[model samples]
Target chain A: MTGIPQEQNDLAYDVFAKACPSRGTLEHVTGRWGGLTLGALHQGSLRFNELRRRVDGVSEKMLSQTLHALERDGLVHREAQPTNPPRVDYELTPLGRRVTERLLALIQCVEGSMDDVLASRAAYDAGQRS
Target chain B: MTGIPQEQNDLAYDVFAKACPSRGTLEHVTGRWGGLTLGALHQGSLRFNELRRRVDGVSEKMLSQTLHALERDGLVHREAQPTNPPRVDYELTPLGRRVTERLLALIQCVEGSMDDVLASRAAYDAGQRS
Candidate 1:
């Protein structure tokens, strides 16, 4: 709490507590598909299929669920243009952008440190085998 | 990758790719219990019971499993002291510390924004009902 931004000090929610709403929102934001979805959208607004492609292995059902959760949480905006087929696009809201900024920072850190992690994993496995 | 640190641009592992090992490590770091466990340990080293207490609602089995995954990833160091009861303490490794720093930033962002998130959820649910 002390190290966090000063504005957060007086907030009513504590994610460490079980019943706090913040915990649920936090889970949605950091969940496997949610995080990737947000990261993919960070580049800009993308269509549904574009998102599925960018997120790699996410199934259609999983992607749709992830988007719905994010939109319900007010982190994503869904826009539908009534064209012949009804073109729909998903984009991060202002709040979503703010949250995704922090998420991307975390992603970058993890991606950068993978070499160290792989080496550590190898050593750990070798120890286990011995 | 464009906005990430310059050193990371050339890395072979990309979290966006489905098969990359970084994706698995990222999940372990950001998963519900894994994130909380690391956050609790970030405060300082703690015994198994102390960690369970600090993390709020984590079950014994989940905590044990989380700790094992983190240890395998080299993000956590588990020390078992030979004593009458054989005390075990969990703490973050240097790599874990780095990952947790970014995760805490994301957590703080979400915690501080809970009021907005709650208001958004209410509005969403009301719209659904109407």
Candidate 2:
């Protein structure tokens, strides 16, 4: 029997499918610090240190890892200037910008509804106590 | 320091700030199996077993945990049917639906661009080796 790669034939990747590559992309964009980093770059290119400051609490190692992953996924552009002490900058690729805009909107939605969420949780916990 | 809690004064919850509550919601919505589970429930209510099946590779423990977190966040409604063999069904709340819809769109975008991503990765790797 001739072998056929099922994934290519499956019009849309099934993130629900454990082996699907789409899950990796989903995780990359939504991964902790992933969305935030994208948002930071949306304004303009940011140097490594500036990005580090923008995304608080991210260790240098984690920030580097996140940037590497996004770059590999074609969502980020990394530029290292030629100098005695190299200066590196990070910016969003066109595809990344498209996705980042949506991610930011999603974040805005959550922020807008946070009051409702806090109220709901408070009520739920109080009811549980009763 | 004037006793104004900084978070309260910050007009919007900042996920990048690390201390903001929005990060919790973002993590919950985009956490492992979170997006998939919500997408599964979006179609209709699903039982515990059915959800586990729908989100491939999710263990019973993880499925239960994800559902509970979503319920706590007011994104999922869990109904435990009283019977000899108890039945539990999970569905998205209005709040949950709103977030799930965005998550699904993000997933779709990633899938649609997988070919581009694959090509980019291949090129990056080839350049690295050269």
Best by TM-score: 1
lDDT of each model, Cα atoms only? 0.90, 0.82
Which candidate gets the maximum lDDT versus the true structure? 1
Interface RMSD for every prediction, one decimal? 4.2, 6.4
lDDT of 1 at A59: 99
CA displacement after TM-score superposition, residue B1 of candidate 1 (Å): 20
Docking class of 2: acceptable
Give the clashing pairs for model 2: none
Query: Which DockQ value does candidate 1 get?
Result: 0.56
Predicted candidate 2 versus true structure: per-residue lDDT over B1-130, tens digit per residue: 2243535634556677788887888888888778789989999999888888899999989888888778888889988899869988889989888888877777766776777777778888888899
lDDT per residue (tens digit) for residues A17-110 in model 1: 9988888898899999999999999999999999999999999999999999999999999999989888999999999999999999999988
Whole-structure CA lDDT of model 1: 0.90
